[model samples]
Structure formats: C-alpha cells, structure tokens
Target chain A: MTSVQIEVFLQTLIAGLLLGGLYALIGLGMTLIMGVMKIINLAHGELMMVGMYIAYWMFVLFNIDPYLSVFIATPALFFLGIAIQKFLVNPVLKVESILPENQVILTVGIGMVLANLATVFFKSDYRSTPVAYATNAFYLSDFWETSPIELSLSVPWTVSFVFAVVITITLWFFLAKTDTGKSIRATAQDLEAAFLMGVNVKLMRVITFGIGAGLVGAAGCLFLPIYYLFPSLGGQFTLIAFVITILGGLGSTIGAIIGGLVLGVFESMTATYIGMGWAPVGRFVIFVVCLIFLPGGVASLLKRKKFGK
Target chain B: MKKFAPFIILTILAVIPLTGLSTYMLHILILVIMWSAIGMSWNLLGGYCGQVSFGHAAYFGVGAYTAGILYSKLGLSPWWGVPLSIVVVSVFSLVLGFIVLRLRGPFFALATLASGEVMRITTENLVDLTGGAMGILIQKRTWVDKTWYFYIILLIAASTFILVRKLMESKLGYYFVAIREDQDAAESLGINTTLYKTLALCISGVLTGIAGAFYTNYMGYIDPHVAFALHDISIITIMIVMVGGVATYWGPFVGALIMVLLAEVIRSMPGLGTAHQTLFGVLLIVIIIFLPNGIVGDYKKLKRLLGFRRAST
Candidate 1:
C-alpha cells in the first residue's frame, strides 16, 4: 500500500480508540448493575436513549451547548435511575428464586416502554446540535508522492477526544476512591455480607444504579455532536455495549473500558477491511469467539494471566 | 375430559367461521390465529425454558424466505416448501442453540438479538439470494385459494395450542419448568438441562418457521424488515406472551387476540398512528406492574365468578 493508504489506516485506528472510550463510558451501567444487582438491565440502552433525548431537548430548547448541559442532565438522570432501582428493580431483587431469563424479560419490557415512550414524545426524528465544531476536522500531515508529495490525511472528532478522555477518567476515579464506591463493590461481591455489615444494601443498589445512569448521561453529552440521536440509535450501540460488558466481565468497571475499546477497534478495523455492514458480524464473531476461549470474560482472562482463574 | 375438550374446541372453531359475520371479521379471525400460533411458538423457548429470546424473528424470517425462494425460483408447491422450511429452520436453531445455549440469562438474550440482526443484515446484503430489502414478490398459486390458506393457518394454530397443552402435561414439560425455576437444582435432580433447553428452542424454531411460511404465502411477498425485525420480537411475540401470561399454553392465544385487535382498531381511528404504539408500550408497562399475572393467570383468581376450577395452578 502507498504511504497515503498507511496514513488513512493509522488515522482510522486512532479514531477507533477515541470512539471506544465513549463506548466504555456508556457500557458501565450494564456491567455495574450485573455486578451488584445480578440483573442485566436491558433498559440500560433505553436509559441512555432518554439521556440523549434530555440532552438533545436541552440543547434545542435552551440553546445550551451539548457539553454544558451535562451538568444538569446527568444529575436529573441520576435521580431517575435511583427511583427506578428503588421501586421497580428492588421488588424483583427480593425473589429468592429468579431465573436469568426472567430478568431479561422484565428489562426488555422496561426497554420497550422507555423506547416507545421516547418515540411517542419525540416522533422518531433524528436530532443533532448545530454547533460549528460538529463538522470540524484536523489534518496532521501529507503523504509522499514520487515527485510532488501531495496526498494528505485528516482526523475528525465531533465529540472531541479530550472530553471523552476526561469523562472516562472521572468515572474511573469515582469508582475507585469513594465511600459509596467501596459499598458498591461490597454489594457486588457479597450481597448478604454487605447487608450484614450495615451498608444499607438497598441504598447502595439505588446509588450504584444512579451512578451508572449518570455515566451514561455523560456519554450522551459526549455523543450528541459525534452522532445523530434517535430512538433506534439505542438499538445500534446497545448491541455493542452488551458485548463490551460481557467481554469485560459483568461487574468490573475497568473491564468495561477495556472491552469497549477492544470491540470498537475491532469494529473499525472490520469496517475498514471488510465492510461497514459487517461491523455487527465482527462484534458477534468476537463475542462468540471470546465466550469460547474466555467464558468468564476478558477481565477474567486478564486476571488469570496475572494470577489464576 | 380429554375426549370432550378437543371436540368442544373443534366445534366452536368450526362454527365461528360459518357465522353471519362480515368479511372483515373473518380477516381478523385469520390474523388472530396466525399471530396466536406464532406467540405460542415463541413461548416454547421464552415462556417455558426461561430463555427469553428476542430473536424469534430470525426463525420466522428463515421460514418465510425459504418458502418464498422455493415457490418463486423452483415452482415447488408451498405444501412441500412449508414443511421443508420448518426442518431447515429447526436445524438452524440447533446450530445457533449449540453456540448460545451456554450463555446465561441476559447474555443469551443479547446473543439471540445479535443473531437476529445478523440475519437481517445478511438478507439485506445478499440481493441475489434473498432479494435484498426491497423484497421478493411471489405470484399467487392457482391450486390453493385464500380460504384454504385461512383454514391451513387455523389448523396450524389449533395444533400449536394442543401441542403446547400436551407438552405442559408431559414429563418433558415438567423438565422445562424445572430448568426455568432453577437450573442447578434441576441438574441435581438428574435433568439434562442443556438437552431440554435445546429441544425447546428447536420446537420453537420449527413452529415459528412454519408460521413464517404461512405468513409469506398468505401475503405473497417476503421482506427482511418485517420478517426479521427486533420490533416483531418485542411487539408481537414478547408482548403477547406477557399479556397472555407466562408459563401457560393458552396465554399467548388470548393475549394476541386482544393486543392485535386493539392495534388494528386503533389504527382505523384518525390521528392515532403514533399514539397507537405508545398505547401498546404503556399497556406493556402497566401489565407488568399492575397485572403481573396477566389476563389468563388473573382469571384463576375469579374462578368462582367464572364458575370454573382454576386450572392454571
């Protein structure tokens, strides 16, 4: 391949890493809920959808910049998450005997409700912030030619990679060094023990769920300029998020980040080498292949190498 | 009880079509039968085995596309094509099940969702084989008329209901319930959970596939969007099952009758296209929250009012 081709390839790889960072941000909810509540929130994507809408409407109505609205929208969603967990999820959590599929059904029902509610309210229209920066791109260098050296390469981030990195790091810090974070970990590891320790297991579940939703809100804030927002858009990223959470391990926060990055990079590579439509095929292949080799998830795979399964 | 129940249902089913009803009512009846049958098929894996697949549309699509291809390309009779489609879809389900059966709970659901997506994408992409997204249309066959199609679907629907009834009474049915309740405990009791789950999926796939063929043949068209969409999974099958009542044979049948009829009726009214879907979504949420037992299950609580013994419990 020519140097111009190499430049384009490198640019795509870098873009994939940046996109993966946001994927990780959005996927934290699925993994966290699974870790603590042992319930996979199928509505996780739907929650993200609502967050996107909230951010979108905030932008449209108040003319607030997409990034700036995160401060308001994230807190609102956080409380919404807490309420849903406390009232809806808590009742189901008490069942001594719950099947995995039952959880899937309940969450699917919740997701359907949220998605259709959005559709009803928003009418399935696509929206994006009309900020001038939404379309800006930066060129790094030109590729060499035999005589003139004329070919060039450019990189684009409507979401801005800096904001994505910042959100990811903030989430990392929140999960690592807070009293609530430790309680969240305790709830995930030993639910009964956490309760026995007077950790208010119920409150912790609501709090963790809230934080998860808040992270997704942050993701939506980051995603508004990068991609168009719609109800159906939830379906697209939700699929990849599922794979990312599973590949990362159900409860591991850091695992979600790594898994998201890996899947995003793999998807970009597949879209580049194979085709755009086959991106899902690439995800499915990786999901199945990973399950075959690393059933506990990629986090376990990593831990196994460092210690042992 | 066994001798009279079938005879009673058969008599009622036969008498309904002959009533002085409008052609529109007949059309609605036919649709109810088909959708109820599809819902029952979904319940086999989802309601019975506790696998909650959101991808029954994949099997449904395969069935429709198979019959459409054979009838259009090879001039084969749908009679043969329909049965052949079921076999093909069952085998496909077996392969998919082998890969995905080990996945627990939401993971399994997500995997099935991905599979449905893959099928949709492939159908849209493989223009030569599946006619792409614009869809392939089939010329109506002269040998079988619309009434014949109606009866065939009705028979299939009744058969599906009876099959589910028989299975629920059998030991295999108990095994399914056991797996759904708790897999490890069931395994401790010597049930082969994997084998039973796979069997449920295979049955579910075959039934759904047959329904697909019947649907395509009835419409004389096949399309990827309608046949293999997540919307179909969520709205048609999952919603009907929940409304009908989980873990019950007749729940889907009753549920589809209500949900579909409501949708059709609402669509007739002006300015309800958008609200129509929201109504169903809100209905689904309300059903889950307030009427967790669903109509069929709730009926048992009114056994004295209905003057019938509570059979569900």
Candidate 2:
C-alpha cells in the first residue's frame, strides 16, 4: 500500500462514513414511522428538507452555529412531526382502514404539499448553513495503510467517522436501554397487545415520530457541513434512506446504521469505478436483488439464522 | 346498454377539436386528452390490480425516446416508431413486473421508484443518445397539424377508455378486483395472480407508451425531466385515480379531466404562475378529505344520497 493511495482511501472512507451518518439519521425517522405508524411516510424526505431549512435559517438569521442549534431545531421538528401525526395522519388512519390505498394517496399528497409549500415559502432557492469548517478536512498521516484481506483493505477515517460511530452507538444504547424505547418496540410488535398491556399506543407513536424527526434534525446539522442543502436535495437522501431502511431490516434502528454505512461505501465505490450514471442503476440493482433474495432485510436474515424462521 | 356507452362517449369526444377552440386552449385540451389515456391505462394496473407504480414514467420515457430517436436519427416516420416504442416499453414493463410484482405494498412502490430514478439519471447522463439535459427537439411538420393532433389525442383517449371499460367488465376484471381485495384469497381460488399482474402491466405500459409517443410527436420535443419524473407518474395515475375512485372504471378519465381543467383555469389566472402548485396541493387535499371519491364517483354518491338505488359495481 503506497502512501498516496492510503491517503485517498482514508479520504473516501471518511466521506463515506459521514455520508452514512446522515443516511442513518434520516433512515431512523423513516424506520421509526414504519415500525409504529405502519405507514411508509413518503413525505419523510420533505420533513428532512424542513429540518435543513430550519437549520439554514437559524444560521443565517440569528448567526447560530448549526451544531449548537440542534437543541432548539430538534424540538421544533419533533413538534411538527407530532402535529402532523395527530392532526393530518390520525384522520386518515380510519380511512385507510377501509381503503388501504388511502394511505398512499394521503402521504404522497402530503409530500407534494410539503415540497410545493417549501417552494412557495422558500422560493425554491437552494441555501445552506455556512460554517467555518464546512470544507475543512483533516488529513491524517499520508503513510498509514494496510491490506487486511484479498478483497478488503483497512483505512483509518478521521473525526467524521468517529462522529458517525458515536451517534450510532448512542442511539443504539438509547433504544436498547430506555423505558420509552421499550414502549416503542412493544407498540411495533403488536398494537392491540400493547394497548391491552396498558401502553398508550398513540402517545408512543407521537413520541416515536418526534424522536425520528429530532434525529433528522440532528442529521441536518451534521449534513450542512458536508453537502449542499436545498429543498429538493431531500429527494436524493430520502431515496438512499429508504434503501438503508430496507437493507437494515424495515423496523430495526441498529440495522439502519450498519446498512447505511454499507450502502454508502458500496455506492461510493460504484461511482468511483463505474460511470456516475450507472451508480443509481447499480444501487437499484442491489435493491432489486436484495428484495428478491432477502425480502425481510439484513436484520431479518440475522434474526432467522438465530431463531430459525 | 353497454354497447352504446362507447359510441356515445366517442361521439361526444369527437366534436371537441372542431368546436373552434383557441390554439392555446386546444393545446391544453390535447394535453388533457393525452393524459386521460395515460391515466386510464395506469388505473388498469395500479387502481384495479392494487399494484401501485411510482415508475410508470419509465415506460412513457421509453416510448418518447424510442419514437424521437427513430425519427431524428433514422428519418423514420413517427407512425412506425409508435408501435416499436410500445413493444419496447411493454417488454420492459413485463420484465420489470416479473421482478417487482411479487413484492407487496410499499416495497413494490419503492422498487419501482428506484428503477424510475435510475432510468431518469441514465437518460440525462447519456448525452450523445438522449441529448442529456438540454433534451431533443424535433422539427414540426406542417401536415401534422395541431387540430389533427387534437383529434388524434381524443381518439386515443376514447379508445383507451373503451378498452379499459371492456377489460373491467370481463372475467379478468373480476380476477383483478379479487387480487386487489385479497391476493392470498384470490390465489387460493386458483387465480394465477402473477399472470394477471404481468398482463395488466403489459396492457398499461403499451397504452402509456403510446400516449408518450403522441406527446413527443405533438410537442416536437422530448426531455428527461418531464419524461421520468415520479411526480408526473404519481399525479396522473395515483392522484387522478384517488380523486376519481380507485379500482373503478371511468375514474381516471373523469379525474384527469377535472384536474387538467382546474389546473388550466388556475394557470390562466394572472399573478398565479408561481403559486400554481399550491393550488394543486389544495385541490389534492380537498379531494382526499371531502370528496375522497372524485367527480364521477361523487356523482354516483350524490345520486345514491338523493334516494336513487345504488349502482352495481
């Protein structure tokens, strides 16, 4: 392994890992909604756009640092999610019971409304939070590389990778250990059973939505330094998030983190090796093949191996 | 009674182009007619079969690009290209259906979406072939007049509606309704769910492809953005069908007309150019909330409300 090659690999790995963190955050929200609401929330991307805009304004108007304003922005988005579920989503739940197609129309219609609403209010101009470190990359020593196996090489990523790992681990612990987390899981397993067990299913759903929104809010803060933020930018991220959510196993948060990182690196490598135009096609091929082979997601594969499905 | 319905609808539609409408109004009407055909075809697969596609634009784009490419590069008549495009896209749809039709619900939608985006990006990136983002513009031939285009679109729309109406009234329609209601139950009853789904998709794709060919030829231009946007597919097939009444014949036709007419009226309003989408959003919300069944569906509802006997499905 030459020094320059090692440097390039490190850079790619760091970029891929940071990108994965953003994917995980967005995927968390989507998976959360899927687990609790049983709705795909096609408008999830627009919600992320909302988060980015909120962060963008906080930076531009009040001179607030993107990372620091996560505290405030997260709660605001949380409230927005709660309100959407309570007012917009609840009414349609009944309708969907009668007509399953109603949910698709409702969520897709909401997505369209959100996108155009953002366009009307924000004027479709792309804006981002301008932080001092937006483009700053920390280059580690240029001579550190080792090949672990024939096909795989090990490279050390910088702070961005650490940030992603830390956030993912934090979320994993929170979900595994917290009482509210238990409520969410219980709700996901079976709504009626959870209700019989005295769980406030609706309250849990609202909180789950809030938590998901808050996660995306944090992701917006993290993402501002890495990529260009625009209203329509959410579309790209949302698609990737869906891939991650599916790859991870539809309702599993930890699976989202691992699956997102894998997908990010896979896509990065494909785009690097193949034509950029083919990258999307490659990703779709992966999705299709996975759906064919492991329709239950990677986590389900693990579950089946463990429990004998 | 069923025999006269198609004749009555075709007669009424035939007079539309010759009614002395303005070119601009005629243009909008042409678009409405084109979309009505596309929407009804979409309703066959999505609304009837319960297999929602967020990627119908793939077939539409294939049709447009096929015809456009043949005409520009090979000096072939568009008439030749239209059928070729339909064959190409129908095959594409069949293969795509084979891959995706087994997946149920949201996964199916997501898979189709991924495929559509991939196609869009491919079209935009293949600059030499697809003209990239700038798109391809064909020279307008004088013989293919705008009024002729209008009647052509009308004929296509009327025929598509009749074909779908026939299919819906057939035994295949019963199988589709059964699949939509409950796939497992239908399968248990010996309905070959896969065959019916692929059949529906093939039919849907061919019609949508033809509409795409008509659009490109009439406008004399083709672009990736308009050709493969998920928004276009969703709005035409999903929203129109939802507003009209999913799984119902004539739903998408009535829905597309109502939507296009309303959209044209809104766009014509001065100072409302940028806010036009907001109107669409509002209309969508209104349709979803109050009039969950679209105009025709609402008509039936109102009739039943006024002490009329319920019409059989």
Candidate 3:
C-alpha cells in the first residue's frame, strides 16, 4: 500500500480504538443489568440520552465542562434507574402476564417517554458541547519531524478514551474487591442460592440497575464532547449496546470489552470501505453472524479455551 | 350468545358506513379496523405462541413495498399486493424464523427489532427497487371517497377475526399455546416446537403484510420511515394487543378502538401533540402494571377497579 493508504489505515485504527473504549463502557452497563435482572433494558440508550442532555444543559447554562458533569449526571441517572425499577418494573414483575417479556416491553415504553420528552423539551435539535479544545489535535508529523506518514489525533477523542479506560479500571476494582459487588455477582450467578445465603437479591437487582444506568450516563457525558446529540439518537445506541452484549456474550464484562473493540473496528472499516449509511447495516451483519455461528459469544470462546488448557 | 357475538359485531360494523358517518369519523373507523387486523396477527404469535416480536414492521414494510413495487415498477394495480404480500411475507418470515426462532424471550424480541431496522436501512439504500427515501406515491388513487377504503379494511378485519378464532380453536392453536407455556415440555410431548413457531410466524406475518398492503393502497404512498417505523408500527402493534387483551379473540378489536380514539384525542389537542408518545408510554406502563392481561382479558379486574361490585350471594 502507498504511504497515504497506510496513513489512512492507521488513522482509522486509532479512531476505532478510541470509539471502542466508550462502546465498551456502554456495553458494560447493559451486560451488568442483563446479568442481574435477566431482562434486557430497552431504555438503556434513553437513560444515556438523559445523561447527555444533563451534560449539554450544564455546559450551556453554567459553563460547566462536560467531563465534570459526569459526576452530577451519573448519580442522577442512578436514582432515576432505582425509581423506575421500584415503581414501573417492580409492579409489572408481580403481575401475571401471558407473555413473560412484559419487563422488556415496559422498558420500551420508558424509552419512548424519555425520547419524546427530550423532543418536547429540547425541540429535537441536535446539540453538542463545544469545548475550547474540540478542534485541537496532535499531529504525528509535528512530533516525529520526519515521519514517513502523517497522522493526527483529535484532543476530545483521546480525552474521552482515557476517561473511559480510567472509569473501566475503577469499575473492575470495585467489582473484584468490594463486598456489595461480590453480593451482586453472586446474585447474578444464582438468584436462588444468593437468596438462600441471605443476600438481599432484590436490593442487589435494584442496585445493579442503578449502576448500569450510571455507567451509561457516564458514557453519555464522555461522548458529548465528541459526538452530536439528538433525542432519536437513543435508539441507535440501544441497538449498538445490544449488539455488543450479544457479541461479547450476555453478562460477560471481558466479552463486552472485546466485542466493543471488534465492533468499533468493523464499523469503522465498513464506513471507510463501503458507504457511511451502511455502518448500521454492518452492525446487524455482525450481529446475525454472531447469532448463527457464535451463539455463546466471545465469552464462550474464552471459556472453551480455559477448559481446554 | 358468545358464538353469535362476533356475527353481531360484524353486522353492526358493516352497517356503520350506511349510517352516513362523517368522512373524518369514517377514516378513524377504518384505522381502528386496520390496526385491529394488525393487532390480531401480532396476538397470534405474541399472545398465543408466546413469541413477542418487536419487529412486525419488517413484515409490514415488506408487504407495503410489495404493493408499491407492483404499482410503480410492474405497472400493476396496487390491490394485487394484498394477495401477493401473503406469498412474499410468508417466505420472508420463514427465513427470519429460521434465525430468530432459536432465541427465547427478550433475545428473540431484540433480534426481530434488528431485522426490522435492517429492512428499513436496506430499503432506504436500494434506491432502484424501492425509490429510496423519496418513497412511492400512487399518483392516481383508486378512489377519492372513504367508503370503499373503509369497506375493504372492515372486510379484512372481519376475516382476520374469523381466521384467528378458527386457528385458536384448532390443534395448531393448542400446540402454539403449549409451546408458549413450556417449550421443553411441548417438545417432550412430540410437538415440533420450531415448526409450530415458524407456522405461527408465517401466519402472523402474512396477515400483517396484508394490512400493510392495504395501507399502501389506502394512503396512496409508501416510504421506508412510514412503512418500517419502530415505534409507530411495531411498538403500537404490541400496545394494541397489550392494551386490548393478550391471547383473547376480541382483545385486538377493543384495543384498536381505544388506541385509535386515544391517538385522535391526543393528536387533536394543540399543545399535547408533541407529547403523544409520552402518553402512549405512560398508558403502556400503566396497563402492564395494573392489567397485565389487558382490558378485555382482565375485564373483571377493570370492572372492580371502577368500583363495580358483584351482587350479594
């Protein structure tokens, strides 16, 4: 390949990796919720949208940085998640319905309300946080003096990627070392056993939902500086998170991380090789292939390798 | 009395146009019947078979596009789409069922949702075949009057009601309910769960496609967004079944009437137009929590909630 081609490839790879970090964070929230609740939260993307709006308003009204708003939005979403679980989802769980997919449908209703409310309040306008450093980028040529190929990285993208990594590390530590986290994991593994062992499985479900919401909320804040925001944007992200969870294997954090990166790279490649409009199609293609060939997802592969060893 | 109830309702609906209702009211009535047809089809799979699809829009859109393509490309009458859609959507559903039927519960729902989106995206991109996002418009509508359109939809809805009722009373219906109740147990009892599930999907998909074909002809327009709308077509289909009654013959009909009227009322209000989805969402949440089985399925609960008491024993 020509030097220009190489440069383009490298640039795409960098962009994909940066985007993957945030995707992993989004997938992590969904997998966690699915593990504990045993139901897919269709409103997961709308919750993130709510977080983005909070960040957007904070930036517009108070000149607060989007990064700082993460601290504010995450907790807000945590409470919102708790309330939804306690009131809307909890009541439906007790009701006897012909279709056991009632909780999933309820989440869809929640998503519709959230998306519609945003449209009403925000007028369906696309907004973005215009940080002073939004356009600032570091050129590889400037640093290498005589580099063979040119490469540039956007400041906001790198910052978001770094923040995503830091947050993921913190989450890992909390899950591994914390008592409540262990209880949550135990409940996810076996609800009956957890309950029998005196774990508050119900409380764990609620808290897991909250944490899932909060994680996605943080992701929304991180994405704000780099991506444009709109009310209808939630549906696409919800699909993305779902695709990641399926590819990563349901409820597997490591699988989600690997799945996110693979998806990001694949999507970036499709955008580059095919047309921009086909990126979403690429996502579904991966999803269908995963379902057909790798039903257990990346986690199953990991499990198989571990067993083989 | 219960057996005659359907015939009585059909007779009443048939004579409504003769009553000389206003065109606007006729339009609403047509929509209610059309939605009921769609809801009944959904109920066949979701309510009885227990496969809650979040992507009925895939079949709906395909059925619509089948008609649109016939009219625009083949220079044929769009009405032919109504019958042709059964063939097209059956094959489509069979293929779709092969992939998605393996999944149970929420996974199946999401897979179907993805398929619907994929169809929409494909339709939008394939400009030559589908006219892309520009949409297909039947320049000369078959009829400017609402009477014929209303009659056609009513016919479709009535037939759908009969078909669903018949299916539910047959052996296939028993198998569907059995699968819904427990897949493993059904399999152990010698029921081919996949085959039955696919059968349900095919029947449901074909019925929905017919409604979609009718929509294209009645509305004289077809677009990716209008045909394959996730919230509007797919979710509303679910809501119609959920709010009316799941696994009940009259559920979709009642749900359609209520939802159609509610939509009209909400849309008519000037300030509340943008918040219609919020109302729909709230209504769905409330129905799921309180009724669960829907208005018709939980009739006694609904009556009791309204403070109706049984006569003293």
Local distance difference test values of all predictions, in order: 0.78, 0.75, 0.95
Over B1-313, each residue of candidate 2 has an lDDT whose tens digit, in order, gives 9868767877777777677777887787787778778888888888788888878888888888888888777878765667798778878888888888878877777777777788889899888888888887878553555788877788778878879989988999999889988999999999999999889989998998888888778878888998888776645566777776666677777777877887778778887766766677666766666556665666666466555444443
Between prediction 1 and prediction 2, the one with superior lDDT is 1
Tens digits of lDDT, candidate 1, A1-309: 886777668766876787787888877777887788877777777787888888788888998887887787789889988987877766654532223354456666667777877877787888777876665554443223343223222223635456767877877676678888888899999999999998988888888889888877777777787788888677766787789987898788888989988987888898888988778888889888888887878778778788854
Two-chain DockQ for each candidate model: 0.47, 0.46, 0.89
Kindly list the per-residue Cα lDDT of model 3 for residues A1-309, writing each as its tens digit: 999999889898888888989999999999999999999999999999999999999999999999999999999999999998998888888888788999999999999999999999999988888799999999998899899899999999999999999989999988889999999899999999999999999899899999999999999999999999999999989999999999999999899999999999888888888988899999999998999999999999999999996
Clashing pairs in 3: none
Question: If scored against the real structure, what TM-score would every candidate get?
Answer: 0.92, 0.92, 0.98
Show where candidate 1 strays beyond 4 Å. Answer: A94-100, A142-159, B1-3, B141-145, B302-313
lDDT for model 3, please: 0.95
Clashes of each: 0, 1, 0
Index of the highest-DockQ prediction: 3
* Model 2, global lDDT: 0.75
Give a tens-digit lDDT track for model 3, residues B49-114.
999999999999999999999999999999999999999999999999998998999999999999
* Pairs in clash, predicted candidate 2: B243-B294
